[model samples]
Target: MKPSFFSQYWCMVSQGWKADLADKERLITPLLFAITVLLLFNFCFEEVSKGIEGQVFTAELYLTTLFALQMSYVRIFVPDQQDKVFSLLQSYPLNYSAWFLSKYTLALLYSLLVFVPVMLLCGLFFSGADLNIWSAELWLGGLLSIIGLSTLGILLSTLTLKASGREMLFPLLYFPLAVPVLLASVQASLSFLTSVPGGWHWMGILAGFDIIYFTLGVLLFGELVTAV
Candidate 1:
């Protein structure tokens, strides 16, 4: 008899988590990429920084995470495919929602660790930017934004699961789909930085984006992973 759906979900999560532990080097790509993006943005927007009332640093924090997470996420499923373990999984009665959430969790954890501290440092030190970088609201909003972005990334990943040019196709599919997350994240971060009145509204919108994608993932992941 087949395992229960919840049991299959847990099994897939454990499998994915253990696999990631053994291949710890894969974690480096997102971390390094995130740092590089933050630095590059800080430099690229140096002139713009002078005009954004130093909210530039906050912009760097969230916007850079937005793009960097998407860029690094294309590789989230590559290792599974390269080893052909997903083929092995196909033999089991596994739910693709499990697969989706497991991948999303790992990617989000790495992105949070790398982006949050650097963003905090910038928020504290960047001149003219007045933000309570230590506030729970900011952290929570950042977390929600990452979650929203990861949800969209996983959805795109599933769509491109078999595409030959996934690297080229992913961004093409991802950026347009992810615009809501991107926009709400920027607005939420800007509100946090400037103490504006409408931050929660954008946060709520980010959370809504997360909910929509997550629901779609649960509903559609089965067909997505099963497609030829």
Candidate 2:
């Protein structure tokens, strides 16, 4: 009999964690890239007002998260893809939903690690932005947006897995699909400064995107992985 879904999921996550441990650089790269992008944004607009700064940084945070997720998605299946191990794994009677969940979980963890610290840093530098960084709405919006981004990331990563010029192809596919989610993230965050009700609406949109992308991933990942 096949392992239970939880059993399969834990096993995949454990292996993924081990791979991350072995390649420390892979784990660090996205965090470093996010910070670098935020730093550049700071330098470019050093004289902007607190309100404008709040909006700019809020937008930057999600944009950085999106780019960082792209970096991570590239490696989501690297371990199994290497050495024909993917084929061996596919031969087993595994649960594909569990497989999708594990990859999504890994990507979500990486995105939070990359996003939260940078978000705190932005709060520190632009405290006058009047957007309460610690607000529940802001955090919820960030979480929902990251969920949507990770969902798209995994699906696109697999879609381009065997294609030529994947590095170039991924961004072409990712950015277009990710734009609406990223926009909702930024709006959800910025709305906190203007109107509480508006913030919730944006968060709802973010959640809707997450649901759509996640459903697509669960349905398509099995076929995408097994395709010739």
Candidate 3:
């Protein structure tokens, strides 16, 4: 029997999700990096705790989480192209747009999987800070950031597929493109931390970025995939 369209798309997402979970090296690297960064911040900032304001530790933690999520997108797509698996998947019955969206969905879900626990742990360590400000707006902003980053990553992954030095190329390409999202996220996060009323505008900016990038990605990705 033929699979339904939704079933086929979800199968693509599930395959991507499982591929991520099963790759212990790829999976653990980000988590360890995040923990190490957090611990280093904790120790490094110990003496300056009194001088620090605005939950600097929490800000660092959020930055670490975002960085890890960005790395995971690299890991997921780069290896698939290296092994020619992405090309094979592209040849399948699923529409290329569905495949792209499925990967985006997987990346977003995987990022949340890593982010939530890290945020909670950071909350525990930084007592007296109202971590409860992780509000609906914050969630929306995060999702937008993820969408924007993942779209960009997908585009770059295709571009760098055959480069001999893609590992180096990935960060060089990713970080510059990611600047806007990171800035918007930081602003939104600061608004959340400060209990400011106008923070939602930052979230709106993030949402707008997501919409613009996702649309651009969908349009540009066909050319990207076919170019190689």
Candidate 4:
């Protein structure tokens, strides 16, 4: 029996995600870096926790989430451009939007995989740390933030494909574009960590950013890929 279009698309996405995970060096590097960042923050806040009583731990978690999202952007886009695989992917019959969405979804999933475990470790290390607020809104906000950052990274990667200094170009172009995501994500995370009311506003911003960038990425990716 022939696979339906959605099935075929999902299969392609799953394959892409597996390929990313199978790259041991690339995959392990980010995981290690994330772990190290968490550890460093834990140590730095060890003494400070006495004064703030948990806000330090909360800030550390928030920073980890932000850093994890940023790293995922580089991981998702840079390697594809460096290896010239994205150009090759253009030869396939896959829908451009589907292809883009697949990449974004994979990055989101990978980010969560790395994030949750590291967060758990953080909780274990910091006695006062709380992971109780793992609600639907927090997860949705994180996913949306990942989607926005991933789209921006993909867009910048496309722009830098032919440039002489893609290494330098990527961070310069990517970080500034990601400021809003970082801000909104941090706000949402703080609200979650503190159990504060009215944090969903930042989540709404994240969703808005995702929708805007997803539309723009879909519209522009076809032209960009064709140009390559």
Candidate 5:
């Protein structure tokens, strides 16, 4: 009898976690890069006017997240590829949707791991003593954007898995497609920080993008993997 989808998904997620944990650098490298970039920005802009500083800080935060997330994206398939596990998986009549979900879940968790610490550190660096940065609205915007980005990342990673010069190809492909999500994320974050109206509008856009990317991922991932 075949394992149920949930069981398979849980198993895949477990394996992915184990693989990530085993090679701790896969998670730590991007995080260190993010912090380094943030520190560089802070040092360079420490003297900027307070009014412009917030805007600059917001841009830096999202840009750092984007760069770090993209760095992590390539590793989504690396463990399976290196271990030839994809071949074994292909031999089974397993559900690719579950596989995609497991990968997507891993990507989401990985992004969160990179995001939360950066967020806290960003707040500490950029926020006023009276400013409360961890509002419910900010969390909603960040999570929704991460969801959309992770979905797209999985699809794109799968698409480029077997391509020549994929290292060169991924950023060429990922950043342009991710512009909408990144923009919405930045705008939503600004709205939340400034207590401005229309924060929901940006979050709604992020949600819409997430649905579209996830739907495409589910429909196309199996075909792509089988072709590899």
Candidate 6:
């Protein structure tokens, strides 16, 4: 009998996690890239107004993390696609929803691994531990953005698997669909930084979109990899 969905999901995530760890080069490069971008943003914004600077910081962080997420998942399907392993896997008596969630979980874990550490370094040292910068708002906003980015990453990965010139086509396909997530992440940070009233609305939008994205991926993943 096939393992339960949770069991299979965890098994897949753990294997992917171990593989990523073994490939330290892949992890180091993107992490270094995130740290470098954070440092540059910190220096650039040092002399700006604190209140509005918060808005700019939020926007910059959101955009940078979005790009990093895209890069991290760029080769998400390389193993299965290149080797055609997915076809064989599909023949197993497994719940494919676990497959979608496993990939999403792995990507989200990597995205947060890159994004959070850099943001923390910037927040504590570069920003002098500003109160507004270290609040639940920033972390919560980041969590939402990560969730959205995870599912979106997987969806985009499958979509571009067989397409020509994927390098050019990925961001073209990814960014437009992710505009809402980017906006919500920025606005949520801005609202928290400025103590504005409307950040909850953006948070709600993020939560809704995360649910929608995950649902679609889970429901359609079987077809998505079949060249949809």
Q: Give the winner by lDDT.
A: 5
Cα lDDT computed for each candidate against the true fold:
0.73, 0.84, 0.72, 0.69, 0.87, 0.78
Please, what are the lDDT tens digits per residue for candidate 4 over residues 1-228? 644557656976787777766776666666677788988876765555444544565566556765665565665655455567766767667676666667666766767776677656766776554544556665665566667877787777677767777768777887788888877876876676667766788888888888888788889987776786
Among all candidates shown, the one with the greatest TM-score: 5
Name the lDDT value of residue 196 in candidate 2: 52
Deviation in angstroms for 77 in model 4?
Answer: 5.3
Per-candidate TM vs. native?
0.87, 0.95, 0.86, 0.79, 0.96, 0.89
CA RMSD per model (angstroms): 2.4, 1.4, 2.6, 3.4, 1.3, 2.1
Candidate 5, 176-223: lDDT as tens digits: 999999989888888888777888998888888888888998999999
CA deviation > 4 Å runs, candidate 6? 43-46, 125-131
Clashing pairs in 6: none
Q: Sort by lDDT, best first: what order?
A: 5, 2, 6, 1, 3, 4
Worst-scoring 10-residue span by lDDT in model 3: 46-55
Model 3: residues with Cα > 4 Å off, grouped in runs: 1-4, 47-52, 130-134
Models ranked on TM-score? 5, 2, 6, 1, 3, 4
Model 3 C-alpha lDDT per residue in residues 4-72, reported as the tens digit of each score:
768877888887767766776887777777777777877777643433444584477568876787677
Off by over 4 Å in 2: none
**C-alpha displacement of 225 in model 3, angstroms?**
1.2
Q: With candidate 2 superimposed using the best TM-score fit, by how many Å does residue 51's alpha carbon deviate from the native?
A: 4.0
Clashes of each: 0, 0, 0, 0, 0, 0
The residue-by-residue lDDT of candidate 2 on 30-134, one tens digit each, is 889888988887888787775576577677777777887789887777777789878887888878898888988998888888878878878876776666788
| Candidate 3 backbone collisions, by pair | none
CA deviation > 4 Å runs, candidate 4: 1-8, 50-55, 77-85, 129-136
**Which is the winner by TM-score between candidate 3 and candidate 4?**
3
